[model samples]
Target chain A: MGAEYDQHVAVTDLGNGGFAAELDEGWVVGGGVNGGYLLGVVGTALRAASPAKPDPLAVSAYYVSAAVPGPATVSTRVVREGRGSATLAAELRQGEQVRVTALATYGDLAGLPDDVRTTATRPPIPPLEECVPGSAAPEEVRKVARMMARFDMRFDPACVGWTVGAPSRRGELQAWFRLNDEREPDPVALLTVLDVLPPVTMDLGLMGWAPTLELTAHVRGAPAPGWLQVRHVTRNVAGGMFEEDCEVWDSAGRLVAQSRQLAMLPR
Target chain B: MGAEYDQHVAVTDLGNGGFAAELDEGWVVGGGVNGGYLLGVVGTALRAASPAKPDPLAVSAYYVSAAVPGPATVSTRVVREGRGSATLAAELRQGEQVRVTALATYGDLAGLPDDVRTTATRPPIPPLEECVPGSAAPEEVRKVARMMARFDMRFDPACVGWTVGAPSRRGELQAWFRLNDEREPDPVALLTVLDVLPPVTMDLGLMGWAPTLELTAHVRGAPAPGWLQVRHVTRNVAGGMFEEDCEVWDSAGRLVAQSRQLAMLPR
Candidate 1:
């Protein structure tokens, strides 16, 4: 048996717009909880607060501090209940200090107009069997970041050259991902998947804890079941920070989600 | 003297984390205040709340409702004051209704390490005099959407073909922008310029209001004094919504600000 995502992320209502959840230790990325996992916790609370619109369309989170594994409380506020969607705010607090704060809009993605027009091209990926496993991380690094074991990940061989001392310095990473439990990808799950890959900075031969400062994700459509293909690219690494843009496509080749985040580089 | 942006977006301290600002009618894009202008209002308040770190590094806002021309209140809360940056939250409320909510990080951009490395390319733009004026809007459009007159804008001609009834249908728009008041572009002003261009939907011959739902921006560096070149591109227009990604380059040819917004297409 392994740590299942749904169970680890589940929240219990604490009454009066409050929720209680546990930050599982197995999800720690670098001395703290993974940002995507914290986002999932906030997303769960927002979904409960806005039941009329349960699917998250867009979520933007600001990581205030490193979250540790322990009991955390989520306070939610329904900002608006519009005709098309609902806007909500949530803060995950370990105690009096807020760990993560987020603003999100939730609605039934199924209800969105079935219109798909795009100039986006589906990136080609080698068959899953031919790609390098995400677990290809050096054993020493994985010893600390237990989060890597929770997902089934495959990386494009060309992008992970840094692992073997052959860095491309391209600042890009392409991977296929899904939960080890075989849970299907939903809008909420996409939140975790969008951030599953290691920081693209690794591809630049710079590898360390690149903590995300702020992350904003847009769920364009519902994903089809199967491995998710994700592409992450970073354009500029300046001001002691860099911005990473992510695009996720599902088994059906539809653009399921897009996200951009600003993160700091290690000193 | 011509409705200077500084005066229009100026916020008065109301004491106790509250600020009062007037929404100018001339800044309305359709039936409401431009999203970026509203972001500036919130940005100004956040700057005041976190004086230790005055520059805006990252900002994300979710539009809750349409903001009409009138008085608005911005309530700000400083979430964290870390050693490197401060995180803040602001709400733009008109009376009891929250028109917009935002989360931002403030820090001295000048204080950031002067490490510059980017794989991004600068998009080419025509000379100021050779391009079409933004005021080239139809006499009717210029009347209601008075926001156009606030700046001296030049289009890449090739992208604004929709104005002449022939659009490239490429889902992109490129232009040069600067305030008519000759105000130099700063971090705050970049908030406005980033959203100044008419919706890129116009590039697809689909001219109408594309109200922004959520906008996230990252200020990479300080700008050099001169006309700013901007490139707007939209790849996925799905589910009654489209996402526009914008890059703002200063005259010194440095990438100053980058923003991505999800907006709804007129039904």
Candidate 2:
């Protein structure tokens, strides 16, 4: 089914060091695909075109309209090239009306000296054996999980029972996650993972349904070994919008990347 | 100089449920004050007029021109009234031209029981004695720090010294900070604090000058106790643009808000 969904989003190599992909209903909500899955498809396409050592640093997508999931296309253009960073702009469209537009960046690896290093504290890692898996995962997660079974995510047992905790003045969460599918690690895949991290954490805390309005991430260092640690926190949930921030650390404790998202809660 | 700067950009209440402020020299650099600060001042003015509690959940601003900081006015209008959220649109004008436009929301606080609650781990707090004060000493700290002094910030000595650690990555830093200002805090102040947090943390780590380009924050809960903790990390630095995400927690470790910002590094 995942492969079937992947097949629907077609990739076009612009040939001029750029690429594009089309996302149609085979990936839309009513058609069984959702935004999350489409995002995955887009990430995969961008990864396929990146250099072997491509490291995705940031991606910003503007949703122009709801992608019905049948047939849509994404086109990417290289906007700027620099020694440290490269910028690429990608657009998802259906027949002419743009559905989504994204600007992503990739960077070459340049190690910082020890004196320049800095790191955020990682949340306590829970033993997978002790933690219970997530309860009825969101439809989006379930769909993505089925389509792309590359990551293993273990939610705290507290998250599954619906006994999560009261919304304190400060919101906080810790989860264990890593790629389930083994392949040459690509920056696009890493960014896709970062985009998904906030929803689960938000779900574990919010009283109502929270749908992401926008998501932005920054890749800081080289990818870490195997397992990735995600520490996510929601700072405020007012109006219909909520905000979440996450820190992604590699198994070795190096800060790999960080993400922030704006989500609109469903009525 | 700082007081003079404030006067130049001082926001004025326009009365009749509207407010205005001028963009002055201090607010502009190459051209204008940072876009994020412009939105922040307008949001602050809107909050002052509404009877509703001031908790900024989401805001959208468009850059029209470089606002001359010396004198500007903000006019806010109620866009919509919903069962749970109130939407407002604010315009910042300098003489006749609309310099900036913004949309903001404040939700009615309906105390609801939280279903999920988990706090992310915070960095180990360094003792005040061991921590180095911010780059500005008593006088500079007093002047520039007004925007930040409301927050209790403890920088890791390594960051202050611009030293990298084993797990450190370039363009990243981890520090603990909370609102320490004595004034009754409002959503505007929260926004101001959020804007101030990232630059300090990033500058301390990268040892580079960083200025904000855009900031979007989600206010999850009402302001917490006097203290709030923040963890800021820079994700990427490329194309003269950089980004950072900050997670804010109250004294109890509950996540209160989180923010993301796009910035330009000083050439």
Candidate 3:
């Protein structure tokens, strides 16, 4: 049997460049399907549309409405075909409603040379034994954010002080992320893990559903089979919205992915 | 008469949810139209599509083909309309060729509450008189990148050492950006200005045409009428590509916009 994540994100080809995916309720957060999980569904469709270009280089999505556990369709349109990459657009729909619109470019990551590589120093986090589990959130908070069960997320003790009613007010979260099933993370998995953390606003004393308006992720490299070090920092929060920037480093000590998202501050 | 920026970005309404725009050669870079200038043209059509919501809150675009000086058409579709914002998709085409595809959210920036505002400190830049004008580039370099003539860009002396055969190898650029005609930058203008600087790869000794594949910008607020302090930094450069993160702080020192773009290194 395939891994749980791969099974849940699987899509049925509709024979005409469309895909049908069933949303799994196990990934719901705050009464709706998690934004990252939805992104993975669309990313899967993009890969299916362009089989030759298997890796997604960059993907950007604008969430129009919250997705629920139900049947949805993804329509893919190939925009351009180049030697190095191909661009495609996809829309997730339910009946007559469009839940998300996205554009992506797919290419072969393994073929690119890593000769000119450099990364800003990865955020310092304590060893795995020193971090707190996502389950550390109060029982009441866990009930509202059930998506936390999908991943084995361990947050830096200093960054999750809000759980005990002592927010650091720093707008940051550093965590180690891995699938509970021990499934290796691929480019598609990076999209979902990039958004798995609780809203950084929780660190600033505002906690609840922070609806994502838009998100963009760049897959810089493939990951090794192990835990992914993830860090989220929100340096700017204004105009009833906050922007969170995230970076994921692999067990091999390489930056695997980067993402930025704009979301509403929980009211 | 309208300002140069407004005139260059103005689009003719097709009255059928489409717009007609003429690509200006003045904004060409590396033998093709600049990506940000193309984004400005599409942002204009998005505003015209949803006249009720005139500000572009978040915009993401993928370049399908490099455009040249010519006529192009923008087709827009309203994906969703909310009380606070509306989402729209646009495609820029020349004849039967699609040059760019984009998605955007429009809203009223003036209506947002600045109550929960915070930002990373602006990069340290020397006084206006102490910085070097973009004209400081060698004549050979200027000939290849004619877009330099459209802006009054003053670069931080510490970051532009590449021009003098002494690259700092930092992969960063800090500059003061303003239209030469002294036009005030609106939300649309912010889209264009975000990509005005030379690619940060130059600082790493990888200069020339670094084609942008995807770019995403979040418009945080309206700007004050003055120079915009801009900073571009590339943290991870690998897989034959690099990702640059940018921030635009208005003259009032309020963070107005942020952008992240994935681009290929010059071959």
Best by lDDT: 3
User: How many clashes in each candidate?
Assistant: 0, 55, 0
Q: Rank the candidates by DockQ, best first.
A: 1, 3, 2
The local lDDT score (0 to 100) that residue B209 gets in candidate 3 is 81
Task: Give the per-residue lDDT digits (tens) of candidate 3, residues B135-169.
Answer: 98888778778788888999999988888778889
Instruction: Please state the interface RMSD for every predicted structure, separated by commas.
Output: 0.7, 7.5, 1.3
Model 2 lDDT tens row, A1-267: 343334444466767534455554332232233454555556555555556426665555444445654555666655445455455555666677655555565555443222223434556777777764443466665554343343456765544443344433345555666654333233454565565443443444554335554556666666656667666666455444555666777767766666666666545
lDDT of 2 by residue, B1-267 (tens): 343323433566767666667554443334346554576677667776555645576554444455654667788776455454555656677777766555566654344235323344555656555665544435543454344343456666655444332434444454555433234334555565565543643443443346553456666656655655556666445444556666666666566666677555555
TM-score of each: 0.98, 0.57, 0.98
Tens digits of per-residue lDDT, candidate 3, A2-54, equal: 88899888999997879999999889888789999999999999999999999
| Local distance difference test scores for all models | 0.89, 0.54, 0.90
**Residues B1-267 of candidate 1: C-alpha lDDT, one tens digit per residue:** 444888888899999889999998878777888888888778888888888898899999999999998899999988889998999899999999999999999999999999889789898778989889977778889877888888888999888778889999998899888887688988988887778888998888777889889999898998999899998999999999999999999999889999999999876
Q: How many backbone clashes does candidate 1 have?
A: 0
- Can you list each candidate's DockQ? 0.89, 0.10, 0.82
Docking class of 2: incorrect
